[model samples]
Target: MYTMNRTATTEMEVTSIRLERDLKDRLKDLAGNQGYQALIRDVLWNYVQQKSGDYQPQLSPEEIRASVEATAQTEERCVLTGKLIRPQERMLLGLTKSGEMVPLSVESLAR
Candidate 1:
């Protein structure tokens, strides 16, 4: 999930490595069906970017969704009204009269 900040916005990466003949064939076979090179570049760049960022955990969509859902359930216990908020939405709003409000996505927010 490492996307480049490029203008055109197509995933791109450059690499210098060697693949064995058999592996190359396998890749070619896969390429015909699945853009193998495109995938390889994306995966390789993901590793590179992740490492560059100190190995942040790459959470899947399901994980994020589940986390958000859990937070929403907990938040529901507190009040019956007020729009459900997402973590990103709260972050975008910043702090109110208090200070920096803890950022939470409606699915993930606890309160």
Candidate 2:
């Protein structure tokens, strides 16, 4: 998940590579469905991850929910209660220090 730093005036590397006609057409079709540049970046990133074995493991919905629950206590705060959340409560109904319920993101649950 590499994102460009907007605060820093850094120039990124840009390269032009040639692709076969068939491949290009297929990519273009996918690009039509997704975004051309985004699709290209995703493909390249996936390839790099595969080669380096740096890909993140896929989490099942249950595991994801559990992880979200476990991590909620660390940093996430209930939007309404302004209190830190806990694992036992549903994210949408998370308790704040004030005893209010709220929602949270999945990333906020990760260690």
Question: How much does candidate 1 score in TM-score?
Answer: 0.33
User: What residue runs in model 1 are displaced by over 4 Å at the alpha carbon?
Assistant: 1-17, 29-34, 54-111
In candidate 1, which residue pairs get closer than 3 Å at backbone N, Cα or C atoms, i.e. clash? Answer: 68-107, 68-108, 85-106, 86-104, 86-105, 86-106, 87-104, 87-105
Cα lDDT tens digits, model 1, 36-79, are 66556666776675446433333322222222122322321111
Q: C-alpha displacement of 6 in model 1, angstroms?
A: 7.5
What would the per-residue lDDT of candidate 2 be over residues 6-70, giving only the tens digit for each residue?
A: 33224546678888889888888877865566677767775575356454432222222222233
Which regions of candidate 2 deviate over 4 angstroms? 1-11, 59-111
Q: Which 10-residue span in candidate 2 carries the lowest summed lDDT?
A: 58-67
Whole-model lDDT per candidate: 0.41, 0.48
TM-score for candidate 2, residues paired by index: 0.39
- RMSD (CA, angstroms), candidate 1: 14.0
In candidate 1, where is summed lDDT lowest over 10 consecutive residues? 73-82
